[model samples]
Target: MNITYNQFLISDDKSLLQLDAICGFLGRSYWADRWSRETIAKSIENSLCYGIYDGGKQIGFARVVTDYATMYWLCDVYVDETYRGTGIGKKLIESITSSDELGGLSGILGTKDAHGLYEQYGFVRIPDRFMRKFPG
Candidate 1:
């Protein structure tokens, strides 16, 4: 899907993504601070990616790991620092959650912050119902 908000365009076209831009942003993120460019590329290759752009420059990004049927995990959500507070993050999430590709599927995400933001879109903390096992 392609959407326009003011001068910005959000698209799911993987070919439109800027690898260096995405890795630069995600590498600095608290969650993926240790991620290598190769890892980021591999992740994008395996998941559904959304790219938010201004003119031709990438300004935001998000990805979803899903089966396109039963479940989806939203991750790697980020908007360039300069683009924050302009509602681009919300629009990205809105576009992802509302896409027909994920219709009727359950969505989940983990964030140390931004709970309030996700809550606005019907996400709720499941209170001890989820667990994780990181690679050792």
Candidate 2:
């Protein structure tokens, strides 16, 4: 599916994702900075991914790990630093949460900051039963 918000293009077409750009975004993120490109690639292959593009260059991305029936884990949400504060991230989340395939399921995401952004989409904080990242 594809959505146009202003001049940006948000789509779930994994084939349009740029590996280098994705790596670059996650590489700088506190959550996944240490992950290898191969690991990232593997993760993307197994999850449903969304990409945000400017004309043709990818500038934002998000991925969902779901069972289609029970629940979904939304992760690796990112927008280029250069494009921050331009509502791209919001649009990205909007596209993901409102998608027909994912809208009705239970969705959860972890964020160190930016709680307000996620909160707007009905993501309430569950501090007691949140998350953990064990080493492999």
Candidate 3:
């Protein structure tokens, strides 16, 4: 799906992704600070990626890893520092949640500091119901 809001555009077009911009953002992000470009590219390859752009430049991104039936994990959500507070992130989330591809699926995400933001979108915290095993 492709959507435009104000000066920003959000699309699921993998061909439109700017790997350099994505790597630059995610590499410096608190969650994926140590992630390599190769890893990022691989993740994009395996997931449904949403790219938020300003005209021709990429400025924000989010991805969903899912089977499109049972479960989905929302991850690597970020907007350029200059673009925060503009509702781009919320729009991105709305786009993902409303998309036909993810309809009726159970959605989950892990955020150390964005609980309030997610809660606004109907995401509720269920204590101790989830677990993760990160690779070393």
Which candidate number would show the highest TM-score if scored against the true structure? 1
Q: Tens digit of lDDT per residue, candidate 2, span 3-92?
A: 999999999999999999999999999999999999999999999999999999999989899999978999999999999999989988
Better of 2 and 3 by lDDT: 2
Residues 1-136 of candidate 1: C-alpha lDDT, one tens digit per residue: 9999988999999999999999988987999989988999999999999999999999999999999889999999999999999998998898888889985799999999899999988799987998889999
**Model 2 worst lDDT run, 10 consecutive residues:** 127-136
Query: Once model 1 is optimally superposed onto the true structure by TM-score, how far is the C-alpha of residue 49 displaced, in angstroms?
Result: 0.1
The residue ranges of model 3 lying beyond 4 angstroms of the native Cα positions read none
Worst 10 residues of 1 by lDDT: 95-104
For residues 1-136, could you state the per-residue lDDT of candidate 3 as single tens digits?
A: 9999889999999999999999998987899989888999999999999999998999999989999889899999999999999999999998888889986898999998999999887789989988889887
Cand. 3 Cα-lDDT = 0.92
C-alpha TM-score for every candidate: 0.97, 0.96, 0.96
Per-residue error (Å), model 1, residue 88: 0.9
Q: What C-alpha lDDT does candidate 2 achieve relative to the native structure?
A: 0.93
Alpha carbon lDDT of each predicted model:
0.93, 0.93, 0.92
